[model samples]
Target: MENKKIILIVLATLIIGAGLGWLIKPTEDKTNEISENHSLESLDHQEIWTCSMHPQIRQSEPGACPICGMELIPLKKEDLGADPDSYQMSENAMKLANITSEIVGMGNASKELRLNGKIQVDERNAYSQSTHIPGRVESLSINFTGEKVSRGQTLAMVYSPELVTAQEELLQAASIKESQPELFEAAKEKLKNWKIGNTQIDRILANGKAIQRFPIGADVNGIVTEKMVELGDYVERGMPIYEISDLSKVWVLFDLYESELAWVKEGSKISYTVNSLPGETFEGTISFIDPIINSQTRVASARVEVNNKDGRLKPEMFVSGIIKNDNTDNDTQELVIPKSAVLWTGKRSVVYIKETVDGRSSFKLREIVLGPGLGDSYVVEEGLNSGEEIVTNGTFTVDAAVQLSGRPSMMSPREKETQKTNKFISVTLSEKEKQQFEPILSDYLEFKDALVADDFSSAKKLVIILDKRVKMLKTSELKEESAKIWGTFQKELIKSTQSMISSNDLQEMRNNFDELSETTIGMVNSFKLTSKELFVLHCPMANSNKGAFWLSESSDVKNPYYGSAMLTCGEVKSTLK
Candidate 1:
């Protein structure tokens, strides 16, 4: 009986062990298979290394960048195949580059006013020194411009015939004062009319002599700004002999731009600096605001009164000034960012926000409501918060990454597509004529590449070349639909290129070029062309040799290859190799 029980226990134990093994065996196999697949994927998508400062420098293995000499950082495996112009930094790379971002917040709304004006003589203190008598200038005491003078100081000697006659009449009247007392009084009054002082007249009367010439004295103390007559020069009646300006008080004129006009008002205090006096600063009070705005610059003039007792400030001196606006009335203080931080897109503005996961850095896009731009910064109207970090420098790179990810950026993808469609509809290109159309498309891509590299000279050259090529293509053979589409595309491309040319913003030119290239490529893909037709009509002058061509028959039309086979001449091929 004991032997039988022991056998049964042993058999049961064996059965239990077998069942456990069956259940656990598949789970281990599945885990191993998943691990193997993950390893294979990682091998295919190996990380690349690059420099932050020199984005163009890329290496398959990790090390320092030769150009920048900064430690190379591993690039995200997923972003390895992104556009060359588009920059994408991995978490480690962002930290190494010291790149950070923050959320945007609303801040107080205040106006920033930029005023421009020149230095001018104070109108109240400016005086024109002139001789009252009709006479000839005998000698000028003040000979040069900017010579200082004092009140009652002699500026010139004038020999006036009328004054000589009046003085002689006074002497004659004095001799016969008892017989013609009224005549003596009239003669004294005539001397006073010629601006002869009472002391000089009394001396002349006491000496019984008639003074032939009188000294022209300065009426107000100032500097000689205009010397009208030289020594021994003939002077006309009531003609100005000299122009004088009192430097004790002066006016500083500022030209305020249209946007800054609202913040600057009469009586605002301003601080200024002159290039001549680098370290010295002066303060003034706003006294006047011009009602008219300049037609060309759209700026209004603002006048400020300055005290220049030291005579350091001179008229026509270039001055740079700042006005501190009182934000007391603006009850709300909102988040503020540097003007350079906001990227404008005609209708909207965008800012890049830095995101952190357990202190690991990443970048994200944020649309912002932008207020008027201050001299160096901007007040955030909305879509931001206080203490949030943002990408102040290298924002263009961040924006490019956002665009590559197919995210809604400052400009929507839908809008871009619509614009491209409209442009394609306006161009005049034949459906079957691939030679002329292929070159235009190829030229656009080259222009885009040049722009991305910030090579303005190359971009301009490409633009000119494209224009010439378009001109050479015969419009007679073009189909109505094709011509209209080509026309629209050309118009838009021309407009964008022209804008870049005018502004001279290399970055904007580059961005526009990218848009144009993408739009052209998309249109080509949508239109469709077969592999055989594409090879026959391919762009011969293409830099990358990746352009497709259309065939004479509609039935042969197919999708152009994109992605891995971007340069392949085929019907949407998955890979080129």
Candidate 2:
């Protein structure tokens, strides 16, 4: 009975343990499945990191940038849309570069014009002191230049024989006043002609003596600038004895360049300070602006009149001033940007416009028709609107990035259509000539792309291929008329190709590229391309703003002239179909 009971206990225990194990196994499997799903969800949310200094660096995980070795930050999630015109920068990059922008609007704009000037004597206030009587200077009270003299103060005592004769005639005339009234009046007039005061004549008549010495008095109150006479020197009538200038009112003359003329105007307010007078400020108005620009100096003088009654401002003292002009004229109020935002190349002024592309800030380099320059800023005549945002600082930094990306910037003005005269000649070509010319055109394109990338070494290598291809053309296959055209085109091609081969300088290469492009276009027009359509692109900012043209396989403009400075500064003019 005991053995049977033990067996029943064992069977019951086994059955209960099996039930508990089955329930726990399903719960553990469900927990493991949930954890695996969570891991997959986290993987889907992974971020891509990029460097601020180097926009080209992109990575899936956070780390240092390969190019600049800067800490990488998470790149904002957005579609990497292809827009060749715009240079996209991540928010992290903008922050790293300290880039900032403002929504430009039509408003009153002002610029602080810092100019260097010098204090000068007002030419209108300058005076020349002359002697009225021919005499010998007996003694001079004004001994040296810079001596201050008041009006009516005696500058010198002179002995004049003419004055003595006049006095003698006056005395004789006084005695014969009843006999000859006209003679007495003539003698008094003679004395007056010599600047003899009536008081001195009365003293002579009262004392009954002929005066030997005459007093020369100052006509104006001023500091002597030039002493023309010495003690005991012989003087002629109407000869200047001294040059004096009133410094109470001084002029601060500033040099304004021809480009700066638009902002400076007569009656503009000026605040200035002289190096000689530290910690003191003086204010004045621009009294004169020379209308004529100096051809040699390319500058004009802007004069400011300041009161120097306290004598703090000295002549020839160096001064610095700020010219304040309202610059709120109708034309100027259209649009304006800070000078720091503009990159000027000859006549072309360019600014980088910030555009939002797929939630990222992208900069597009745009050429603007500039109006008057208002000191630290420029008036925008064209190419921008009221609400557009532009780079106010770190302009060069953004341009550098554009260059690396092969886009346009300041050094490269955007492209425009070529003139009708610059167009390729419309001449048909024989099959053999077409075959010979097309390869050369292709090589020329390669050379152009090398230059666009600013790879001088690669450009040099491609130029060799261009030279070889040009020489490979055969003149025998064409008829007389076709051969002549071929000869002309070949000569231009060889000349331009040779010019490129001879120079290692990137700038010179770009210069030669202009001629190369023109000749290639002519060749392609004469004998059409068999493979792809060619684009005749022109950059208005190239070749010192005179503009230049180049050929490319794609419609996109890659300016060889500016290279990295303005990588994308051109546009497609027409296609060689």
Candidate 3:
């Protein structure tokens, strides 16, 4: 009985110890589960949120993009695996934007160069009818301009006292012809000096009387453009009496701009039409191109000699012409792209290349070298492959997205230091020219500020002032290189300012500002501003997604393109010293 009690006590103690150990182990497992939950909560707090349109805008928590005011979405870890130089968008977003791309390849490209010109009289075929004898006009046969006259036709009758005296001498000499034969020949020679024909001399000798009045004959068949003599008008020898031109051949002088100088050559063929002659077409070959380009007009004349025997083409008639020129030499093919695919920033030509990002569509902005502009397209010289895909339509949208993401774009670059090194020869201006151009810069800043504030009326008023200031630029003192730059800027400034002033809508004015800023920036860079410290600023949301740049007196960020929606959205791109 004693042994049984000991064994029961030991068994009871063992059972109690085992049950307590089980309860303690459950508490430890619960603690471990709580710690794991805490770690997961910490990871959730570290998530990053960003705007889809503006991926550059990053926040620790959910918020809106600072630049575009777009709602921020959570960034996934898988998105980080995409290319750093490219950007990604959803299929729905791509469809909504209507973005399209095409594969560039080599092909033969030709451009039709349209030119305006006028028909002019062939200078070589023109002549001036003049008299050889000094006389007084007795009667006028050709009364007005545009009267056609034939060769050897008598145009007017003149009375000459000298001729009558000479005839009298001849008559006297004829009386002593047997003894003074030399005298008779001498009198005949004097009449010949006055352009009197042999027949008229014979008639004078036959009649044996002095003829006082002489008839002046036309030298060539032509229509009279000017009559220098009137009835009873005294004229001197060698004086031009009538200005005449033959319409057998005519010259078509076409105005060629500096940009078109390359395509037009001496032997190029051209087909033209005139508004006066409906449903009629004329063809001619270029005979000559003016060696000198006009300073004011910035154009040269291309001459085409055309046979106008039919008289269908008249002088001073306005005409239009088309010149079909091949875009290459040696007939080799080249890569070409539509003009819409390019984003010209004055300093650079950029295109957005399509890329695959995380198994989806994306785009990367790339700089390219352009060869020739073939009307609606351009030939690619460098910076692209033969089979590369490029954005052909809605390129502006892609560029805008690239800018919003703070990547290299038409207006913005990832590394601005690279752009600071300019390859183009710098245009230098004198101190006087720079001083005179300071007011233009001031007026431009004012216009830019108005657009930034989204004040259309103020912007229009300021653009008017800006236009006058740009027009007032003293281009007279500029050197040849500087004058070329000035000419280019003047054309662009007039176009932009006029467009801005005529537009009442804020968006259009902003669009005009983009072009205006491009010209202004180029001017500033080429001339090297001195009076003020100009800062180049950019706004990615302007011009319907195409980014734009503006000049500012200060480095402070003021969103001129976005206005009150996002007041301070841009950064200083460069400081012009």
Give the best candidate by TM-score.
Answer: 3
13, model 3: CA deviation in Å?
42
| Tens-digit lDDT string for candidate 3 (1-577) | 9999999999999999999998777576788998989997786557788766566666788976766666788876545556556778777788899998899998887788999999988999899999987889998889999998999999899898888999999889989989999998998999999999899999998998999889999999988988888988899989999999998898999999999998889999999999998898878899999999999999999999988888888899999999998846747898899999999989789999897776788788889999989999999989899999999999999888877765667877543322322533467777887887788888888887887788888888889888888887777777888888788789989999999889979877876777788788877887886566778887666655556678888888887777877767666778888
TM-score of 2: 0.59
Comparing 1 with 3 on TM-score, the higher-scoring candidate is 3
List model 1 lDDT by residue over 433-544, tens digit each.
Answer: 7665677767755664454355668877887787666556666676767666656556655665565555465545533443454445444543442232322122211222
The runs of at least 3 residues in candidate 3 whose Cα sits more than 4 Å from the true structure, single-residue gaps closed, are 1-79, 416-577
The lowest-lDDT stretch of 10 consecutive residues in candidate 1 is 568-577
TM-score order of candidates, best first?
3, 2, 1
Winner on TM-score (2 vs 3): 3
- After TM-score superposition, the amount by which residue 520's alpha carbon in candidate 3 deviates from its true location, in angstroms, is 31
Task: Output the lDDT of residue 493, model 2.
Answer: 79
In candidate 2, what are the lDDT values of residues 440-493, reduced to their tens digit? 877887888899889999999999888887787777877777777777777887
- Give the Cα error of residue 503 in candidate 1, in Å: 32
In model 3, what are the clashing residue pairs, if there are any? 452-560
Which ten contiguous residues of candidate 3 have the minimum total lDDT?
A: 415-424
